[model samples]
Target chain A: MSEKPTIEAYLKNIEEGHFKAYKCVDCGMIIAPPSGSCYGCGSSNMKWAEVSGKGKLVSFTVIHVAPDQFAEEAPYYVAIVELAEGTRVSARLLGFDPLKPEQVRLGINLKLDYEKGKSGATYLAFKPA
Target chain B: MPLNNTNIVSAAQTKFGALTGVTLREIFSEAVDKATIHAGIPKKDIQAAFIGSFIPEMLVHQGHTAPLLLDFAGLKGIPATRHEDACASGATALRAAIMAIESGLYDTVLVAGVEKMTSVSTSKVTEALAAAADDQFESSIGLTFPGVFAIAAVAHMQKYGTTEEDMALVAVKAHKNAATNPLAQFQKEITLEKAMTPRYVAWPLKLFDCSPISDGAAALVLTSNEKAKKYTDLPVKITGTGQASASMNLCDRSDLTSFSASVDASRQAYKMAGLKPKDMDFAVVHDCFTIAEIIASEDIGFFKPGEGAKAVRDGITALDGDKPINPMGGLKAVGHPVGATGVKQAVVIYRELIGDAGPNQVANHDTALMHNFGGTGATCVVNIMRRADL
Candidate 1:
């Protein structure tokens, strides 16, 4: 009952410095990037559920040729992080040299954060825990 | 490969490159006219049309392109539809014709794809093409197609020890094959050092590792089995057709090393054709990037999970190797017109099967496979075609 189970609501929370997830009210399942229906049982019943903001890196990329908005922010790392709530989200990876790709490891622990991009857009980001 | 009566009687394509003084209308009409003439049928004989177009609206300020393209082909009111699935739009449009024939809806159909990208600036084209990714999540975070595939490249390297050298080998092989294709965009071959030394588009992915943005058009004439023999002496039977989709976002996928869509589609296509990947004589997969070809080869069951990189490195996927791949140069060098790439892949294999591939012919290219992939592995279509004489 903290906030509506909408992506806008989820982003609002992230913008206000909190990483949120969606939990199925019926089956107690959790998912990220907010879905209209439950992935576990296809139930539309859902609510905003807070997560630990802790996860592990699954896969990642260092973007050199960015879109027009982020042209100045080339050579940034984007990663897929699995949360403790058993859901995954795409976020920017920070606190590591982008040129040294070999130093990055898979399945490493990361902590969630939020930042503003050159496009003046807020996005989810993460750092090595 | 099922025993259906759908066959490709004729196919044609405009040379893929920076074609000047040609409008989309001219490019599409040229391919249509050539295909119609080769089919030995008047344009009036065409019953329906399907077009694969990604961004006529964005690039040309055109919408409802199906009828417009149909009008250009002289088939104005015959139930035309334009399909859009990012890069897989060509195969998606091709599927409509196949379905129309399978359901007895139309005996003769025109399947075509066209894209004019060079007219716009490179930044405008980049913005337009980025529409294929997950706009809300992936693209919002500043990921381009090159960056998307770069992640896959790095993941493959980390998981299976795939080296950048192995990735460069794919580019080398692709250019070698393209040099033989007179219609290909980049007919000049490059060494591995040249390919590797180029400026990086994304980390671990150089400029040479990516498929070029091209302008081209291709058309195919399809007919029901009963009508195929009357049109052309050499008919390539579309024995198996399979399409599958995955998560829209790259991060949502459980595995980055392989695309589930390709695996599911190829498995279904193989099951329908009653043959396995090993039985295929050759293949043309979606090599949008060098790493993509490696992953696609593995995803299509042509090689083991991690062997795709090594396959290219060990000459296992060369033109004369045991499993020949991309003899028509693939998208790497043949040019990817985005919406037209998948259809061009089909046309290449079709030519190889009919013994019309001047000197690029393989010894055993009797049966072939073509993999058409859309954005970020979201949509994929795998097709198995066999020589009519077989």
Candidate 2:
């Protein structure tokens, strides 16, 4: 039995300015932000590896009405990015105006980035590579 | 699994428009009393209870609600349970009660779903509802329900050439039907131009496209097949029930145009009922947004993958169409009281199928299907019901 990795550790690595993902030792499936078991092979045997930090925008939405915590950040862009590893994750889309959603295109090449929120917590974001 | 003749003998719901000053428990009790009394069943006859609520605590600062609701409805001592699956909570509760009866654990069960959402500001309500999404991934960054579905709408448009005009047609149809539904939230008809011009909540998804923030309650009196005849001869037989869960994040899914949970759950439902989608005379789907209706139409196999929008455009889903969907105005106009939406669908279908939809009933009425969906298709509950004579 392998020791399960925590999300905290994965985020901590990101805090250290390194993008790390868990790859299934059995099937080579790369999962960002890690999981307890491999979706492809159900293998507990996993290893932490650095990601290429490259992805493409699959879908996105401009949240005009934000939550209370994100009120000042209203009209922000959030999108799902499909990474080079074939794993998808939701992150903030930077380097663009949130009010102008028509300008953003799907399948656009992007690179992994980070943004600090009002709470000073680091969040995953993507920008034009 | 096939429901073993667990039938809804009587179903009732309060008017689904905005109502103020009523506690959540009061709304629940009203629905339970109306349904059981209409079923001609004594309070003592209900052996168990199942309730569904979403963000009730956020709206009213109330929690541990099942007991209080059951007690208010005069069924305090019976074993009671609660179900929460985002917007599918109401149907989840009904499914649990049905299973309890089918498993021989109880002969009769009272199922209720209620949500009092109008009490708070829409911003706060939006925050509470965003809990349905993955906080770490989506909502934490301010992704609301409208945004998630809008992204799907955009994907559908990119792949299928579905236009904003096609989506607007869905809202037009919903409002046209809702104008006739006495209990609907929006009781006025809207033109295609109006739907198109409505302010945008998210790109490609406008105010007219989104289901309104509603507060309401719905309840059903269900009993086993053997005991059903004692309550009513016109019971709605729940022949099939299928529930499936999916990844909460839409990114995990391969396709953004359709909900895999809906496809999977409907497959299980069709298998259990010994029926096919073509056999459905009518259906009430989870049209939380205009684009959602189009996607749901295809996901449930009523239309082809991208043909759902075409079906909407061609008027194939209208009240007079070949396959009428959401004859009772659906969530778009009927009002989506998250927890209550699912059970309300059942109640409306049971009433409409038995020629009880008042002025809003469609022409077809033999076999019907009801779909309840939770958060971006993360969970879905699909059930096939038939009039007892059928």
Candidate 3:
């Protein structure tokens, strides 16, 4: 068992150039972006562990109309990436033209990465590996 | 198996649109007044109030809204509580009122839902609406409601070969139905060309594919079956209701093509009513986005999975079609004032069942279903209502 996985700690790890998810100590199931209880077997016993950051592009959307916070980054790709650990996470999808969604292919391999927003905050992102 | 306990005596709502300069209290009271007056019941008869307002705290800087709106509606000195489950806030409130009546705590109650969204900038409203999603995983990463649905739309398209044209047809149908709905926001029909040409709000979801941000309120008066007889001869009975929730984050869902909570809720509602999808005369489903309605059509079992769009293309969901849906235009053209939407669905169904839907009236109104979900299908509420005489 290690320090409980809080979103703050998860981001802190991301900011430090590491991607970690909660691995249920009981069932060995991975819970990404961290959760107190395991979705697999409903156990709260979990430990922080690093993931391979490898996954496939499951589904995606190009957001032309963004929220106020991300207005400056309009016309960006947001995608659901399934980590090789079998857990899915939503992240910024890069290395593709958002305007031409016809070219973006699903099931493309991707690797976990980080990007900086206009507000100088680091965020979890994914790019074609 | 039907819920013989509670009946809807009356339902009312302000025109769904950008009601500029209209305060929440005024619109809310207006709806309350219309419902009570239509039912011919004095406001004093409402034993308690359950109100729903999704993001007034962000949109209008108002909190503790249950008492504020209730006081303005002359429903003061009664026990009032507010319910919030994102966009399904109103249905949650309605469910609570139903349970309260069933529990014998109160014979008569009022349920209301409202939102004043157009008062703010579009970007601000978008930001406010995004709060409904999981902030850490979804909204915080720049996912808007349109974006969330777009993701689902893409998945549905991929798995079922549902084309963008299939989705555009939904918008066209919504506008056509809305043309005859007096209280709808957009009363003019749109061509498929117009729907297809709109810029992408989120890819696979065009601007026309989305519902507008509006301000409005809807209220319903409910009483036990015995008390309903004192009001109107044509009371609509709420025979079945089911509310269920799923993971707050879309990433947690195993499939993006359909919403599990909707299926679970509708199944529960159908079982309770002792009815099936074929028995429903019509439906008022949450069409927050065009794709949502298509997915909802399947989720409620009206159409098999991946067959909803085909049904739409075949005119099966039109006003005169075999299984009409959103005969009052739905959130698409009716305007989605978030919280008001769920309550408005029931209002539409009640009017249809009572033969008051005017030009949008369908041939059969024996029974209908209303499906409303909050956020990316995280919270879903399904209800079946029928004429009490049935």
| Root-mean-square deviation (CA) per prediction | 1.3, 2.0, 1.1
Chain A TM-score values for every predicted structure, listed in order: 0.93, 0.90, 0.94
Worst 10 residues of 1 chain B by lDDT: B37-46
Per-residue lDDT of candidate 2, residues B1-390 (tens digit): 556668889899988868887878888888888998765788889998989998788888988889988888889899887888999999999889878888898888888899999888987888888889987666765678999998899899988989889989999999989899888999999989899984778776888889999989999989988998898878888999999999888777888888999999999999999999999998899999989999999988999899999999889999989988898799999898899999999998899888898777879898899999998789999999998887
CAPRI quality level assigned to candidate 2 from its DockQ score: medium
Clashing pairs in 1: B1-B272, B1-B273, B1-B274
Q: Local error of candidate 3 at B68, Å?
A: 1.2
Candidate 1 or 3, higher lDDT? 3
Q: List the residue pairs that clash in candidate 2.
A: none
Q: Model 2, A7-121: lDDT tens per residue? A: 7777776666666788888898998656778889888878877788999999887777667787777677888899998998888889998667778888899999987777566
Which regions of candidate 1 fall more than 4 Å away from where they truly are?
none
> Positional deviation of B240 in candidate 3, in angstroms?
1.0
Q: What are the lDDT figures for the candidates, one per model?
A: 0.88, 0.87, 0.91
How far off is each candidate at the interface, as Cα RMSD in Å?
1.2, 1.4, 0.8
DockQ winner between 1 and 2, please give it.
Answer: 1
